[model samples]
Target: MNDNHSSSAWSTYSRTVFIAFAMIALGLIANEHRVHVLGILPWLLILACPLMHLFMHHGHGGHSGHSGHDHASHQAGPVQPKKEADDV
Candidate 1:
């Protein structure tokens, strides 16, 4: 029931934290061999940049409200509004 679901969520969270820490530890070990790593660093970055740009920005998503218009240079020069955000 509720207890089972709560325990399951906690277990998943704990496992995720454990894996994150393990990765940090592995990264530190790799950093110790940074001299060897740096030799391929530039090549890795050159390859990754294009791949990430292509994959990550593949989808143009639901910003349908945006008309792709540049209304910055309107007939009415400028209008500054009051602060609308409520205090937290």
Candidate 2:
């Protein structure tokens, strides 16, 4: 049982070390290509707008169901002046 516990601890330690190394490598690579990344940042933002719009509205069913959305239904015919009690 003690040996098994040690092996598990070692496994966890190795995994953590591997992740640390991978992050360091990725960071270095990203630093080297930062200029290229910045160059494409604007295009990425533009592309994300439409992609986000499509995905964000997907849950509530797109604009097709909103065809009846108009101010006409909300307006109670022409407004009439209120009659004064004194006039009555």
Return the top candidate by lDDT: 2
TM-score of 2: 0.50
Give the TM-score (vs. native) of candidate 1: 0.30
Candidate 2 per-residue lDDT, tens place, 1-88, comes to 3655453645877989999999999999999999999999999999999999988986452356666555554545978899878764
Candidate-wise lDDT, in order: 0.77, 0.80
Candidate 2: C-alpha RMSD after superposition? 7.1
Candidate 1 — which residues are off by over 4 angstroms? 1-32, 61-88
What is the Cα-based lDDT of residue 79 in candidate 1? 82
Error of 2 at 63 (Å): 5.6
